[model samples]
Target: MLTCDHPFPLDQYDDRVKEHLRFTGFYHASQIGIVQCQKALVNALVERWHPNTHTFHLPIGECAVTLEDMAMILGLPTDGLPVTGITMSNFETLEAECLHQFEIAPRKSNYRGSGIKLTWLRDLKERLQLTDENNIQSIGQYSWGSACLAHLYRALCRASRFDCKEIDDPLTLLLVWAWIRLPYLAPVPREPRSFPLANM
Candidate 1:
């Protein structure tokens, strides 16, 4: 099975934690942020029909907090960390190393014929379209960039084949490229009166 490792340092500034929560689509609750993010991400992956059998190798300490602690924090089942091995924190450049490994990982068997069946991209596109129609302004370049990358990663992960070559179909390639380049485009601002303001 194709495995991708993402090692994030939770020890970084508080902003990093918030950013991680935002990127992973989980509420930034300190007590359960890590586990909530993990569950949200995993659930999203499953919703995309990614076979539940795939492996996720999460490293504790440097890359992230311990899964046991995460579970306790989230009040979830403790299965001794979902996957087999956790990455070590001793590695000096953990993120770079994990990304390098991800670049070469083989494709999962269950995802052989399917090419990018990610709903997140569709959802993002709808949100972007709504933003354009309503003239809603995005938070910043970083937020947009992160969203674009998330869409791209979802596309790449789902489209990947056993040979690791994304499907060469023109439409799929075009869509993926569009998502990747979304950050470069001008922001679409949300129009005034798009929604009724609540009374303070």
Candidate 2:
């Protein structure tokens, strides 16, 4: 139930990405902290996913997404090493990100934001067993609706059988979508990336 029929926005980064981190109850980074924490996050995630590398396509605005470009965009270090489509923890955790910035009053009479695509995320949040006692929607609005894609990718990873120390397969992208697209914890930009999802 971790993922179903959705894709994680592995490449997207919101300008207020820290707000998403806050959703996971991780809002202690300042300007430097923002950059530092993101770098740390990327390093930790990349290390875990290094074993699974995929030759996937990544398109940036008006250009192809190189590792350096990704580093610049996401505040990651340019180690010259390629990146996995995903990394880090799944959406379910003790972490709780507050939703004041998103104008989400989970405790209010009614919550906000709606769209046909968003229905999947709302469902995914329920599947993850998150609550809304403290204006906590778990998933925020930074990301339009990429969880459904991640869900689908997770299914693919589960179905694929690959052995390591043999053929190098970038199957982590398929495997770690849920972990990477964690609602607010894994917030993407409110505005869609200029790159097309189909390009990937």
Badly placed stretches (over 4 Å) of model 1 are 14-159, 165-200
Candidate 1 accuracy as TM-score: 0.21
Per-model RMSD to reference: 21.3, 16.3
TM-score for every candidate vs. truth? 0.21, 0.18
Give the per-residue lDDT of model 1 (tens digit) for 3-86: 332323233335644654444333222222111123233332223333232222233211212323222223222332222235
Off-target runs (Cα >4 Å) in candidate 2 are 1-98, 105-117, 120-200
> Lowest lDDT 10-mer window, candidate 1?
191-200
Give Cα-based local distance difference scores for all models.
0.30, 0.30
Evaluated at residue 157, the lDDT of candidate 2 is 38
Task: State residue 57's C-alpha deviation in candidate 2, in Å.
Answer: 16
Clashing pairs in 1: 116-158, 116-159, 134-190, 134-191, 135-189, 135-190, 135-191, 136-189, 136-190, 137-190
Per-residue accuracy of model 2 over 87-111 as CA lDDT, tens digit each: 3232221112213233222332222
